[model samples]
Target: MPFQHPKETGYGHVIERYVTRKDSDHPRYLELGSRRVLRPGWPHAERFTRHLIDDAAAITDVELEALLAYEWRSRLTAAWLIGVDQRTSFRERIGDLLLASEVCYSGGGYCFALARLGTHADAEILTAYLDRYLPRTDLRYDQPEALGALLRLDAHLGTQHADRFTEPDGLWDQWVQALAHLQDSPDYTPAEQRRWTDLHCDFASGWARP
Candidate 1:
């Protein structure tokens, strides 16, 4: 039988086609096969997440929360789809979701994603989690990557409610501390700095007085 459009037959058939591929050893075949499933309107992204959650696969509760907390539109949509399918309590589960996303995923992009989500009503729990997570000096706070993620979160969400750690406290101070941590490291590329600076400056200038 020929593969039908999602509208013609729904998403289950599409998933079945993707999962049944026998040529797992062929990279090009696998890539094309994956793309075939992920094409713009297939709707399997949500279906996959929901399947994973419902089956209670090896994925941990924290991992599930992280998947839900992902900032990418596609990923978030998938997470929402999963939440809808499971009929889980989003408000009750939001804190864990945010924490899992923040802790498990690294990179400025993830931070920005979390910040965007933070603007929502469910994000207050996320903000509270950060307050508790960032202050533990005993933990690995010295890493520039960790600091960068914090800076990105603060950059997007603003730093008013959280307690200050770096001296000369305020948003600027937090950013500077993050920058300084990255300064001596060779791995800290200029492009990353430029990106962070652009976001930081744009945000800072928005509130500047005439």
Candidate 2:
């Protein structure tokens, strides 16, 4: 699918009012913490990560739902909050956003949230995403993260939900092929490349990355 930036929010709409907002001068935790996670040697990254997790866990369900109803940044943070709190109530909404892929940069957050939810129903949502979107290799979207989440859940739950996709010439192959193009794109950067692998680790560990 082609990229489409979301349109509707008014110009100068205040983002700081959202629970996902960082201090007025600081970057959102997802943006800064993700970079720090990829480069663990960064000073104070671990401490910051701990704070981020605590803050996420503290967000109320009403605040979280409001975040989900906003743009990618808010949605991403909201998903992380739900995952951190194991708020299963938002599983369906997060799954719907993952499948919708309505906005950019939030799909990984949705996948991670589902992985943290850690239930058969969560696995079903991840599997449905893979079944529907993995065939479209042209769109990199969040297929890899979704697959990684499902596989991790399968390992922990002792199920084979990912077996069908991992077989030779299956969805896994499509995902790999998609990655090659993503890597080859001129806009791709080392940080961007590492982000995917970092997300895999985050999924496996339920966003507890250091």
Candidate 3:
């Protein structure tokens, strides 16, 4: 099924108000959330992660949900906020967004959130996403991250839920075969062992440090 129009997916007034803010009212967290991944070695990456995490923590659940309804930038930051806080209450909704795959760039955040939640339910969601999207070789949306998250959950839960996907002639194998140029490229890494490291990891590290 195709996605609903962006105009129809979100609360227009709410998203407009949130996205059009000035200075302090603006959601700086959205802009800062990806800095860690984009500039991993910069001295300020950790600080940016900490600052965004703090900002995310300050957002209300209603506000966060509204952000999730908006475009990729807002959805990405909202997912990070929800994940960092381990708000399992939003897990189903986040899972829906992951399966929706409505837009690019935000799916990794959804995968991150589900992985942080780390429940059988979350694994199911990631599995469902892979089950649906992995076979579609034309679409490159978050397959790596979703698979990474599912494997992470399997590791944490002591289960083999990811085996079906990793096995020979599996969806993953088919997906790799579709990547014609990248098939034997030395630079290509399989999603099974790939780590979708992003802002959440940096925030966790910043908090864990004494």
Report the number of the highest-lDDT candidate.
3
For each candidate, the alpha-carbon lDDT, in order, equals 0.37, 0.68, 0.69
Candidate 2 lDDT over 126-182, as tens digits, reads 999989998887777887678778877787789998889878767666566567766
Report the error of model 1 at residue 152, Å.
7.2
Winner by TM-score: 3
Better of 1 and 2 by lDDT: 2
lDDT of 1: 0.37
For model 3, the stretches where C-alpha displacement exceeds 4 angstroms are 1-40, 186-193, 197-210
**Model with the higher TM-score, candidate 2 or 3:** 3
Per-residue lDDT of 143-172 in model 3, one digit per residue for the tens?
877887888788779988888988987888
- TM for every model, in the order presented, reads 0.32, 0.74, 0.77
Preferred candidate (lDDT higher): 1 or 3: 3
lDDT measured at residue 170 in model 3 versus the true structure, 0 to 100: 85
Worst 10 residues of 3 by lDDT: 17-26
> What's the candidate order when arranged by decreasing lDDT?
3, 2, 1
Clashing residue pairs, candidate 2? none
Once fitted onto the true fold, the runs of candidate 1 whose alpha carbons sit more than 4 angstroms away are: 1-94, 100-103, 106-110, 118-123, 141-159, 162-210
